[model samples]
Target: MSMANLSFLNVLKLDNNQFTGQIPLDLRRLDRIKEFSVTNNRLTGQVPALKKGSVSVDSYAGNLGLCGYPLPLCEGSTKKARTGVIIGAALGSAAIVALVVGGGMMFVMRKVVRKKKEDPDENKWARSIKGTKKIKEG
Candidate 1:
Protein backbone atom coordinates (compact mmCIF):
# COMPACT_ATOMS: atom_id res chain seq x y z
CA MET A 1 0.00 0.00 0.00
CA SER A 2 1.16 3.56 -0.76
CA MET A 3 0.74 6.56 1.49
CA ALA A 4 -1.92 8.82 0.07
CA ASN A 5 -1.03 12.51 -0.37
CA LEU A 6 -3.48 14.65 1.55
CA SER A 7 -3.72 18.42 2.02
CA PHE A 8 -4.12 19.46 5.62
CA LEU A 9 -4.73 22.96 6.93
CA ASN A 10 -5.29 22.46 10.67
CA VAL A 11 -3.43 19.18 11.26
CA LEU A 12 -0.51 17.34 9.63
CA LYS A 13 0.04 14.17 11.60
CA LEU A 14 3.14 12.20 10.53
CA ASP A 15 3.88 10.55 13.83
CA ASN A 16 6.20 7.52 14.13
CA ASN A 17 7.63 8.07 10.67
CA GLN A 18 11.30 8.01 9.52
CA PHE A 19 11.12 11.59 8.20
CA THR A 20 14.27 13.54 9.24
CA GLY A 21 14.96 17.24 9.12
CA GLN A 22 14.35 20.44 11.09
CA ILE A 23 10.62 21.02 11.49
CA PRO A 24 9.79 23.76 9.03
CA LEU A 25 9.55 27.30 10.37
CA ASP A 26 6.83 27.82 7.80
CA LEU A 27 4.79 25.27 9.74
CA ARG A 28 4.08 28.15 12.06
CA ARG A 29 2.73 30.07 9.04
CA LEU A 30 -0.43 28.00 9.12
CA ASP A 31 -2.25 30.74 11.00
CA ARG A 32 -5.55 28.98 11.50
CA ILE A 33 -3.90 25.90 12.99
CA LYS A 34 -4.89 25.38 16.59
CA GLU A 35 -3.18 21.95 16.81
CA PHE A 36 -0.06 20.70 15.00
CA SER A 37 2.07 17.66 15.71
CA VAL A 38 5.01 15.65 14.38
CA THR A 39 5.49 13.34 17.34
CA ASN A 40 7.87 10.35 17.00
CA ASN A 41 9.69 11.70 13.94
CA ARG A 42 13.47 12.26 13.55
CA LEU A 43 13.02 16.05 13.42
CA THR A 44 16.01 18.17 14.49
CA GLY A 45 16.18 21.86 15.32
CA GLN A 46 15.46 24.56 17.85
CA VAL A 47 11.71 24.22 18.48
CA PRO A 48 9.39 26.43 16.51
CA ALA A 49 7.45 29.17 18.28
CA LEU A 50 3.83 29.06 17.31
CA LYS A 51 3.12 32.37 15.56
CA LYS A 52 -0.52 31.60 16.19
CA GLY A 53 0.20 30.40 19.80
CA SER A 54 -1.05 27.83 22.40
CA VAL A 55 -0.93 24.28 21.13
CA SER A 56 -0.89 21.39 23.69
CA VAL A 57 2.53 19.92 24.64
CA ASP A 58 1.41 16.51 23.38
CA SER A 59 1.66 18.18 19.99
CA TYR A 60 5.46 18.01 20.31
CA ALA A 61 5.90 14.74 22.10
CA GLY A 62 7.95 11.56 21.24
CA ASN A 63 10.30 13.34 18.83
CA LEU A 64 14.01 12.79 19.63
CA GLY A 65 15.62 15.99 18.32
CA LEU A 66 12.91 18.61 18.90
CA CYS A 67 13.46 21.01 21.77
CA GLY A 68 11.93 24.01 23.56
CA TYR A 69 8.50 25.05 25.02
CA PRO A 70 7.11 21.60 25.80
CA LEU A 71 10.27 19.55 26.21
CA PRO A 72 12.14 18.45 29.33
CA LEU A 73 14.82 20.98 30.18
CA CYS A 74 17.89 20.69 32.43
CA GLU A 75 15.29 21.55 35.12
CA GLY A 76 12.96 18.74 33.92
CA SER A 77 9.29 18.57 32.86
CA THR A 78 7.36 21.23 34.78
CA LYS A 79 4.89 22.94 32.46
CA LYS A 80 2.15 20.29 32.60
CA ALA A 81 1.87 20.13 36.39
CA ARG A 82 2.30 23.87 36.78
CA THR A 83 -0.60 24.59 34.47
CA GLY A 84 -2.84 21.99 36.17
CA VAL A 85 -2.05 23.31 39.65
CA ILE A 86 -2.64 26.89 38.62
CA ILE A 87 -5.99 26.08 37.07
CA GLY A 88 -6.95 23.89 40.01
CA ALA A 89 -6.01 26.55 42.55
CA ALA A 90 -7.90 29.21 40.70
CA LEU A 91 -11.02 27.08 40.50
CA GLY A 92 -10.70 26.08 44.16
CA SER A 93 -10.34 29.70 45.24
CA ALA A 94 -13.30 30.71 43.14
CA ALA A 95 -15.45 27.98 44.71
CA ILE A 96 -14.48 29.19 48.18
CA VAL A 97 -15.24 32.79 47.31
CA ALA A 98 -18.60 31.86 45.83
CA LEU A 99 -19.56 29.94 48.94
CA VAL A 100 -18.52 32.83 51.19
CA VAL A 101 -20.34 35.45 49.15
CA GLY A 102 -23.41 33.28 48.78
CA GLY A 103 -23.46 32.59 52.50
CA GLY A 104 -23.10 36.24 53.28
CA MET A 105 -25.96 37.09 50.97
CA MET A 106 -28.09 34.40 52.58
CA PHE A 107 -27.25 35.76 56.02
CA VAL A 108 -28.33 39.26 54.97
CA MET A 109 -31.50 37.92 53.43
CA ARG A 110 -32.31 35.88 56.53
CA LYS A 111 -31.81 38.92 58.74
CA VAL A 112 -34.24 40.96 56.66
CA VAL A 113 -36.81 38.15 56.72
CA ARG A 114 -36.46 37.73 60.48
CA LYS A 115 -36.77 41.47 61.03
CA LYS A 116 -39.90 41.52 58.89
CA LYS A 117 -41.37 38.59 60.77
CA GLU A 118 -40.54 40.13 64.12
CA ASP A 119 -42.12 43.48 63.35
CA PRO A 120 -44.35 43.34 60.30
CA ASP A 121 -46.44 46.34 61.47
CA GLU A 122 -43.30 48.34 62.31
CA ASN A 123 -42.32 48.53 58.64
CA LYS A 124 -45.54 50.25 57.66
CA TRP A 125 -45.58 52.61 60.66
CA ALA A 126 -41.86 53.23 60.35
CA ARG A 127 -42.33 54.44 56.79
CA SER A 128 -45.19 56.76 57.88
CA ILE A 129 -43.11 58.25 60.70
CA LYS A 130 -39.90 58.74 58.67
CA GLY A 131 -40.95 61.97 56.93
CA THR A 132 -42.80 63.21 60.01
CA LYS A 133 -40.44 62.21 62.87
CA LYS A 134 -39.52 65.78 63.76
CA ILE A 135 -43.13 66.82 63.72
CA LYS A 136 -44.10 63.92 65.93
CA GLU A 137 -41.08 64.47 68.18
CA GLY A 138 -42.07 68.12 68.62
Candidate 2:
Protein backbone atom coordinates (compact mmCIF):
# COMPACT_ATOMS: atom_id res chain seq x y z
CA MET A 1 0.00 0.00 0.00
CA SER A 2 1.19 3.55 -0.79
CA MET A 3 2.12 5.34 2.42
CA ALA A 4 1.71 8.82 0.91
CA ASN A 5 -2.00 8.95 1.82
CA LEU A 6 -1.29 8.10 5.43
CA SER A 7 -1.63 11.48 7.10
CA PHE A 8 -0.97 10.51 10.71
CA LEU A 9 2.05 8.20 10.22
CA ASN A 10 4.87 9.13 12.63
CA VAL A 11 7.38 6.28 12.08
CA LEU A 12 7.45 4.06 9.00
CA LYS A 13 9.75 1.06 8.62
CA LEU A 14 9.27 -0.68 5.25
CA ASP A 15 12.75 -2.26 5.11
CA ASN A 16 13.42 -5.73 3.67
CA ASN A 17 10.36 -5.46 1.46
CA GLN A 18 10.34 -6.09 -2.31
CA PHE A 19 8.97 -2.63 -3.06
CA THR A 20 9.84 -1.64 -6.61
CA GLY A 21 9.82 1.78 -8.37
CA GLN A 22 10.21 5.14 -6.64
CA ILE A 23 8.97 6.32 -3.28
CA PRO A 24 5.74 8.24 -3.75
CA LEU A 25 6.20 11.99 -4.22
CA ASP A 26 3.17 12.73 -2.12
CA LEU A 27 5.10 11.44 0.89
CA ARG A 28 6.78 14.84 1.23
CA ARG A 29 3.46 16.33 2.27
CA LEU A 30 3.33 14.28 5.43
CA ASP A 31 4.21 16.75 8.19
CA ARG A 32 4.03 14.39 11.14
CA ILE A 33 6.36 11.72 9.71
CA LYS A 34 9.41 11.85 11.98
CA GLU A 35 11.16 8.61 10.90
CA PHE A 36 10.97 6.83 7.50
CA SER A 37 12.81 3.97 5.85
CA VAL A 38 12.51 1.92 2.66
CA THR A 39 15.80 0.08 2.66
CA ASN A 40 16.52 -3.25 0.90
CA ASN A 41 14.07 -2.57 -1.90
CA ARG A 42 14.25 -2.23 -5.71
CA LEU A 43 13.41 1.49 -5.57
CA THR A 44 14.97 3.72 -8.22
CA GLY A 45 15.31 7.40 -9.14
CA GLN A 46 15.75 10.38 -6.79
CA VAL A 47 14.63 9.63 -3.25
CA PRO A 48 11.85 11.86 -1.96
CA ALA A 49 13.32 14.68 0.13
CA LEU A 50 12.46 14.60 3.79
CA LYS A 51 13.10 16.95 6.66
CA LYS A 52 16.81 17.61 7.16
CA GLY A 53 18.61 15.44 9.76
CA SER A 54 15.44 13.51 10.41
CA VAL A 55 16.57 10.04 9.25
CA SER A 56 19.97 8.39 9.02
CA VAL A 57 21.45 7.61 5.59
CA ASP A 58 21.86 3.99 6.62
CA SER A 59 18.11 3.62 6.34
CA TYR A 60 18.46 4.05 2.57
CA ALA A 61 21.19 1.51 2.00
CA GLY A 62 20.78 -1.48 -0.40
CA ASN A 63 18.74 0.49 -2.95
CA LEU A 64 21.29 0.40 -5.79
CA GLY A 65 19.40 2.71 -8.16
CA LEU A 66 19.03 5.56 -5.65
CA CYS A 67 21.17 8.70 -6.10
CA GLY A 68 21.20 12.02 -4.25
CA TYR A 69 22.89 13.64 -1.30
CA PRO A 70 24.40 11.05 1.11
CA LEU A 71 24.51 8.69 -1.91
CA PRO A 72 26.73 9.09 -4.97
CA LEU A 73 25.50 10.86 -8.08
CA CYS A 74 24.09 8.49 -10.67
CA GLU A 75 26.42 7.88 -13.62
CA GLY A 76 25.68 5.65 -16.59
CA SER A 77 29.06 5.94 -18.35
CA THR A 78 31.30 5.22 -15.39
CA LYS A 79 32.20 1.69 -16.50
CA LYS A 80 33.02 2.81 -20.02
CA ALA A 81 35.29 5.59 -18.76
CA ARG A 82 37.09 3.22 -16.43
CA THR A 83 37.63 0.72 -19.24
CA GLY A 84 39.04 3.37 -21.53
CA VAL A 85 41.56 4.44 -18.90
CA ILE A 86 42.71 0.86 -18.34
CA ILE A 87 43.19 0.24 -22.06
CA GLY A 88 45.15 3.46 -22.46
CA ALA A 89 47.49 2.58 -19.61
CA ALA A 90 48.09 -0.91 -21.03
CA LEU A 91 48.94 0.49 -24.48
CA GLY A 92 51.29 3.04 -22.96
CA SER A 93 53.10 0.37 -20.94
CA ALA A 94 53.49 -1.79 -24.04
CA ALA A 95 55.01 1.07 -26.02
CA ILE A 96 57.50 1.85 -23.24
CA VAL A 97 58.51 -1.81 -22.95
CA ALA A 98 58.97 -2.14 -26.69
CA LEU A 99 61.19 0.94 -26.86
CA VAL A 100 63.36 -0.25 -23.95
CA VAL A 101 63.80 -3.72 -25.47
CA GLY A 102 64.61 -2.30 -28.91
CA GLY A 103 67.17 0.07 -27.43
CA GLY A 104 68.81 -2.78 -25.50
CA MET A 105 69.01 -4.90 -28.66
CA MET A 106 70.59 -2.03 -30.58
CA PHE A 107 73.21 -1.51 -27.84
CA VAL A 108 74.09 -5.22 -27.83
CA MET A 109 74.38 -5.28 -31.65
CA ARG A 110 76.65 -2.24 -31.59
CA LYS A 111 78.92 -3.87 -29.00
CA VAL A 112 79.12 -7.05 -31.12
CA VAL A 113 80.04 -5.02 -34.23
CA ARG A 114 82.73 -3.10 -32.32
CA LYS A 115 84.20 -6.34 -30.99
CA LYS A 116 84.28 -7.85 -34.48
CA LYS A 117 86.00 -4.78 -35.91
CA GLU A 118 88.67 -4.76 -33.20
CA ASP A 119 89.70 -8.32 -34.03
CA PRO A 120 89.18 -8.93 -37.77
CA ASP A 121 91.70 -11.76 -38.11
CA GLU A 122 90.78 -13.89 -35.05
CA ASN A 123 87.55 -15.73 -34.29
CA LYS A 124 86.19 -15.77 -30.71
CA TRP A 125 87.73 -19.25 -29.94
CA ALA A 126 91.12 -18.24 -31.46
CA ARG A 127 91.23 -15.01 -29.40
CA SER A 128 90.53 -16.93 -26.18
CA ILE A 129 93.27 -19.43 -26.96
CA LYS A 130 95.73 -16.67 -27.85
CA GLY A 131 94.97 -14.80 -24.60
CA THR A 132 95.45 -18.04 -22.60
CA LYS A 133 98.81 -18.71 -24.24
CA LYS A 134 100.00 -15.20 -23.48
CA ILE A 135 98.98 -15.54 -19.83
CA LYS A 136 100.78 -18.92 -19.50
CA GLU A 137 103.99 -17.53 -21.08
CA GLY A 138 103.94 -14.52 -18.69
Candidate 3:
Protein backbone atom coordinates (compact mmCIF):
# COMPACT_ATOMS: atom_id res chain seq x y z
CA MET A 1 0.00 0.00 0.00
CA SER A 2 3.09 2.25 0.13
CA MET A 3 6.05 3.13 -2.05
CA ALA A 4 8.55 1.75 0.45
CA ASN A 5 9.35 -1.37 -1.55
CA LEU A 6 10.81 0.63 -4.40
CA SER A 7 14.35 0.29 -3.12
CA PHE A 8 16.24 1.44 -6.20
CA LEU A 9 14.17 4.57 -6.60
CA ASN A 10 16.25 7.57 -5.59
CA VAL A 11 13.93 10.37 -6.64
CA LEU A 12 10.18 10.59 -6.84
CA LYS A 13 8.24 13.56 -8.16
CA LEU A 14 4.44 13.34 -8.13
CA ASP A 15 3.56 17.01 -8.03
CA ASN A 16 0.28 18.39 -9.36
CA ASN A 17 -1.42 15.03 -9.36
CA GLN A 18 -4.89 14.40 -7.94
CA PHE A 19 -3.54 11.99 -5.36
CA THR A 20 -5.52 11.62 -2.14
CA GLY A 21 -5.11 9.90 1.26
CA GLN A 22 -2.29 9.96 3.78
CA ILE A 23 1.38 9.86 2.88
CA PRO A 24 2.93 6.40 3.16
CA LEU A 25 3.86 5.84 6.78
CA ASP A 26 6.74 3.60 5.67
CA LEU A 27 8.28 6.35 3.59
CA ARG A 28 11.03 6.70 6.16
CA ARG A 29 12.52 3.46 4.84
CA LEU A 30 13.54 5.05 1.58
CA ASP A 31 17.09 5.67 2.64
CA ARG A 32 18.37 6.58 -0.81
CA ILE A 33 15.70 9.14 -1.60
CA LYS A 34 17.90 12.18 -2.08
CA GLU A 35 15.06 14.26 -3.56
CA PHE A 36 11.29 13.91 -3.33
CA SER A 37 8.31 16.08 -4.14
CA VAL A 38 4.56 15.57 -3.83
CA THR A 39 3.32 19.13 -4.07
CA ASN A 40 -0.09 20.36 -5.24
CA ASN A 41 -1.97 17.19 -4.37
CA ARG A 42 -5.12 16.54 -2.36
CA LEU A 43 -3.29 14.45 0.24
CA THR A 44 -4.17 14.71 3.92
CA GLY A 45 -2.82 13.80 7.38
CA GLN A 46 0.57 14.27 8.97
CA VAL A 47 3.45 13.84 6.59
CA PRO A 48 5.86 11.05 7.31
CA ALA A 49 9.27 12.26 8.42
CA LEU A 50 11.93 11.54 5.86
CA LYS A 51 15.62 12.16 6.04
CA LYS A 52 16.70 15.79 6.38
CA GLY A 53 17.01 17.70 3.07
CA SER A 54 15.28 14.80 1.35
CA VAL A 55 12.02 16.70 1.39
CA SER A 56 10.87 20.16 2.35
CA VAL A 57 7.55 21.89 2.94
CA ASP A 58 7.65 22.96 -0.70
CA SER A 59 7.17 19.32 -1.52
CA TYR A 60 3.93 19.23 0.44
CA ALA A 61 2.24 22.54 -0.36
CA GLY A 62 -1.40 22.86 -1.53
CA ASN A 63 -2.73 20.18 0.84
CA LEU A 64 -5.00 21.97 3.29
CA GLY A 65 -5.56 19.04 5.70
CA LEU A 66 -1.89 18.40 6.29
CA CYS A 67 -0.51 19.40 9.69
CA GLY A 68 2.43 19.18 12.14
CA TYR A 69 6.04 20.43 12.17
CA PRO A 70 6.59 22.46 8.97
CA LEU A 71 2.95 23.53 9.10
CA PRO A 72 0.85 24.70 12.06
CA LEU A 73 -0.96 22.16 14.23
CA CYS A 74 -4.50 21.31 13.15
CA GLU A 75 -7.42 22.74 15.14
CA GLY A 76 -9.31 20.41 17.49
CA SER A 77 -6.63 17.74 17.26
CA THR A 78 -6.29 17.90 21.04
CA LYS A 79 -8.91 19.75 23.06
CA LYS A 80 -6.66 20.33 26.05
CA ALA A 81 -3.76 21.46 23.87
CA ARG A 82 -5.92 23.89 21.94
CA THR A 83 -7.47 25.23 25.15
CA GLY A 84 -4.04 25.82 26.68
CA VAL A 85 -2.91 27.73 23.63
CA ILE A 86 -6.06 29.87 23.68
CA ILE A 87 -5.72 30.59 27.40
CA GLY A 88 -2.07 31.56 27.01
CA ALA A 89 -2.85 33.93 24.16
CA ALA A 90 -5.76 35.51 26.04
CA LEU A 91 -3.68 36.10 29.17
CA GLY A 92 -0.87 37.62 27.13
CA SER A 93 -3.25 40.01 25.39
CA ALA A 94 -4.90 40.97 28.69
CA ALA A 95 -1.51 41.71 30.24
CA ILE A 96 -0.55 44.04 27.39
CA VAL A 97 -3.89 45.89 27.50
CA ALA A 98 -3.73 46.26 31.28
CA LEU A 99 -0.19 47.63 31.09
CA VAL A 100 -1.14 50.20 28.46
CA VAL A 101 -4.31 51.31 30.25
CA GLY A 102 -2.63 51.41 33.68
CA GLY A 103 0.28 53.41 32.27
CA GLY A 104 -2.12 55.90 30.67
CA MET A 105 -4.10 56.25 33.90
CA MET A 106 -0.94 56.84 35.86
CA PHE A 107 0.22 59.46 33.40
CA VAL A 108 -3.12 61.31 33.56
CA MET A 109 -3.25 61.10 37.36
CA ARG A 110 0.29 62.40 37.66
CA LYS A 111 -0.56 65.34 35.41
CA VAL A 112 -3.62 66.17 37.51
CA VAL A 113 -1.66 65.93 40.74
CA ARG A 114 1.19 68.03 39.38
CA LYS A 115 -1.28 70.65 38.13
CA LYS A 116 -3.03 70.72 41.51
CA LYS A 117 0.33 71.13 43.28
CA GLU A 118 1.27 73.97 40.92
CA ASP A 119 -1.95 75.90 41.69
CA PRO A 120 -3.77 74.67 44.81
CA ASP A 121 -6.75 77.04 44.48
CA GLU A 122 -7.61 75.81 40.96
CA ASN A 123 -9.37 72.69 42.33
CA LYS A 124 -10.89 74.03 45.62
CA TRP A 125 -14.72 74.08 45.66
CA ALA A 126 -14.97 77.36 47.67
CA ARG A 127 -12.22 79.40 45.97
CA SER A 128 -14.64 81.23 43.64
CA ILE A 129 -17.05 82.12 46.49
CA LYS A 130 -14.15 83.30 48.66
CA GLY A 131 -12.85 85.49 45.81
CA THR A 132 -16.37 86.96 45.29
CA LYS A 133 -16.79 87.68 49.02
CA LYS A 134 -13.38 89.43 49.16
CA ILE A 135 -14.28 91.55 46.13
CA LYS A 136 -17.65 92.53 47.67
CA GLU A 137 -16.09 93.47 50.99
CA GLY A 138 -13.20 95.41 49.38
| Highest lDDT model number | 3
Taking all chains together, the TM-score of candidate 2 against the true structure is 0.47
Q: Which tens-of-lDDT digit does each residue in 53-112 have in candidate 2?
A: 386678788888887555675575477779999999999999999999999999999999
User: Over the stretch 1-138, how does candidate 3's per-residue lDDT look in tens digits?
Assistant: 558988767888888997999888688788778888888999988777776455767878888878755667656668878799999999999999999999999999999999888777775666556556443654
Sorted by TM-score, highest first, which candidate order results?
3, 2, 1
Model 1 agreement with the true structure over 64-110: per-residue lDDT tens digits: 67766666452333677688999999999999999999999999999
lDDT of each: 0.69, 0.79, 0.80
What residue pairs clash in candidate 2, if any at all?
none
lDDT-better candidate, 2 vs 3: 3
lDDT, candidate 2, equals 0.79
Which model is ahead, 1 or 2, in terms of lDDT?
A: 2
Model 3 misplaced regions, further than 4 Å: 74-138
TM-score for each model: 0.41, 0.47, 0.50
Candidate 3 lDDT at 7 equals 70
